[model samples]
Target: MCNDSKIHGFLEKLPKCEHHVHLEGCLTPELMFTLAARNGIKLPDPETRPEFSSAESLYTRYENFTSLDDFLSYYFIGMSVLKQQDDYEALAWEYFQKANADGVHHAEVFFDPQEHINRGVLYDTVVSGFTAGCRRAEKEYGMTTKLILCFVKHLPASDASKVFDLAVERGDFDSGVVHGIGASSSEVGPPKDMFKEIYATAHSKGIQRTAHAGEEGDPSYISAALDAYKSQRIDHGIRLIDSPSLMERIVKDEILLTVCPVSNVKLRCFDHISQVPIRRFLDAGVKFSINSDDPAYFGGFILHNYCAVQEAFGLSIADWRLIALNSIEGSWIEQERKLELLKLVDEHIDKHLAD
Candidate 1:
């Protein structure tokens, strides 16, 4: 964003909290091949899907994504290789290392259990591996993590309900193995209230909730998530700008919007990073956190997302401080942990801008 090394250093050191990154989305092409070969899984022939030939070729294909569904096609292909608990653990550890290097102190990650269940991978395998990775992150990097089991919305609600029942049977929410639930994938076609009953159950039990809204869909998608799903946070609510009243309501309620800059441009939601409306949201008093929704596919990680926003908007120190605070506030962590993050931000502000 700035030529000044001091400002750049400050951005690098800022503690980040990502709420929208999907664990499966972090499956890099290199890892996919390793796991595929280890598990004896067959990838599509090179003639039909040339991207399967090599990691380099697959990454080249990632650069030309035309839409969310287009990227998802490749995303699911990458997940085919993750056949064992170790594979899932490796995938999360890989992402956690990168996140730690980028200064992430806390994270609420998303994973689709239904997708894995359909693949014949047991739910316990997925949770244990990811949970193991999270524990390692906490021990080694001192970073806390919360897992959010996301439902593949394009799948039948009956499928999701079944998964929900399994989660309840396992006491996933009550025991905190999974912190919450969210709806994702194919946002446009799914009925807005498809997960209403599930949300009602979660709300009745006082569990946390969130959803992907207003990213590929319209502002009404965001409203439905609130009115119907009663989500505490809105993931990718960039389209909230289209509805003034919705924007007002969001500000009044202090609902956090997890906005992904590079993902939006890659998915063609916006033509360029500059079109992401960073300054608009800041000026309008809308609380939002910059994230890399699917960094492996979208071409950047959390720091890369932060750099893109800064390069586009040249936001001042106060602006960045606010953004960092907004992210911390939106994090579904304990109040004591939230206070610690706030203290870190204050230290960074003093160290970086003390000149």
Candidate 2:
């Protein structure tokens, strides 16, 4: 590991923006137990559900998932413990505090409404609590946040449309709390083309669009998301490197890729962190940023992701600066805020050099 104090200091001080984290995925086992007890829900028995046996055992099992499907089985189980608005608010608030301490000044968080609604949780309860949590984070930690409602692609398009309509009916699209729409989960059958109508509705309402594509899907999925869904940014677009033409298009269009190194490794997208192709993306002029897709499950947060990549790739201070700047630029925030964060990045880098 590169343990140079200067490099560590630079990473600690650099301002960051995390664009692709699932709020539910941020639930740690410690919090899981706390929330489960508060809600009077009993976690599955250890004999039957060894994954929930103990916090340490759960983490060990989390590290052993053979595929994305395996990880999600546990992911949904973690969601079941959350039943009320207070639960949701506490979840978001905890993430904000941890993210703030990690040097994240801005975060665009993803949440799956259908996951909660299918479990009998109301959409109003979810949004109201999450929005309140964002306000609290801003007030307490000066952390700017925006929520993105991610439609699970494995679900029917009609179901996703209902979620979109709910957001629209509640004026979430205009509320400034919910800033965008995204597609996530099981990118196998329901292609990005499936969400065309939903994206169109969001665009019509002036909400930003983004989607998870090319993590395990083909490069063509990335193309479909860009062309059909008109995605402003792509989450986990690491496979774009497979198609040089598509990569060129991404660079030309400047579609930002929120690449998660630890998630990629944990999900078996890459055999090791060194094989993640971050350097290749940099060389190709692709606009990309580091993120922690499902930090709790993937065993790393945004800062840990950055540090792992830095050590694996032996990234210089200049490289770290570009990555930090790309995160702010890729964020769905106002240009004024983007510029302000960029200035913070520059000042941090300059301070490190002077030291």
Candidate 3:
């Protein structure tokens, strides 16, 4: 087999799993307009306004965001059109179809409830609508999905706690639709300790926990998330590279870091693709997974993320294989399912080599 061709084919056919994707973040402009029209919401004119015309324009507008707050502003703006269950259902279904087309078999989807709730979109409205899509996606596409309810970090921890309690009380997560609790939003405000009590409550309820740390924050935040909340995963712990000791601890504990390369580029997390530390983490035996944090705005999905980094750094076939395996290792699926997916990935690589 031609080495590059074989590797490219394997990537296309790999049975992948994503651990760090946002629900509303996956809303494409095409679907955005469709949902807005159906919901009778008015979007800025795409005709007179050149910025809302296509995916390219949306990506250009998004790339200008310099901070987490800037990204959140647009993120919430695109989500404003989603006012009902059908809107949420359409978003979830659309994401699942895209994932399916990209060969993703399992995913742990993150949703920022605080964003929707503050906008008068009930917690159940967001949860149930996506839950409906998960059910249908499973039946129709053979995809397994789990939801991670994320707390907007800019909000007070007490408000985050309220959101968690509501999810539990309303039974929005009882059926495994909502499997874990996560922390997202601007990383600059509300130090990690702010969410200590909220994480404790989530821990007490037997819910899995994870947090976004070390993306734009200091390596100390990564330590805080693990030490304070005992998070099972760390989202975009990129700054962990700044501290050798913390990097060792993360690898020692086998905690997963859900790294979003495209989002990082758009948010200016790294100056260039070469600065991404995925290879460094891998070489050091740190567990990490690639994901598209906000694909709608970030110009690429999960596969595009892998392809971009792979080409940027001249990753070898073995490296790509390890990256694919890393995704399975970081997934929230059951052990049996994880094993099955690994086998499928291996089979895909083998088939590609044969071809």
Best by TM-score: 1
Q: Write the per-residue lDDT of candidate 2 for residues 1-355, one digit (tens) a residue.
A: 2377667667866899999999999999988998898998888898988777889999998888777777888888898899989999998988888788789999899999998988789998999888888999999988889999999977788888998888888888887768999999887667559989988877777789999999989999999999888999999998887899999899999899999999988988889999998899888888898888888888878888888888899887877877887788889888999999999889888888887
Q: For model 3, what is the C-alpha lDDT against the true structure?
A: 0.84
Greater-TM-score candidate between 1 and 2: 1
- Candidate 1, residues 165-257, lDDT tens digits: the string is 899999999999999999999888879789999999989998899999999899999999999999999999999989999999999999999
TM-score of each: 0.98, 0.97, 0.93
Highest lDDT against the true fold, candidate? 1
Superposed model 3: Cα runs more than 4 Å off = 1-5, 42-57
Model 2 error, position 47 (Å):
1.7
Which ten-residue region of model 3 has the weakest summed lDDT?
A: 1-10
Which is the better candidate, 1 or 3, if ranked by lDDT? 1
Clashing pairs in 1: none
lDDT-based ranking: 1, 2, 3
Clashing pairs in 2: none
Local accuracy of candidate 3 as per-residue lDDT tens digits, 219-300: 9899999989989999999999899999899988999899888788888988777789977987999888888898887887
Q: Which portions of model 1 miss their true places by more than 4 Å?
A: 1-3
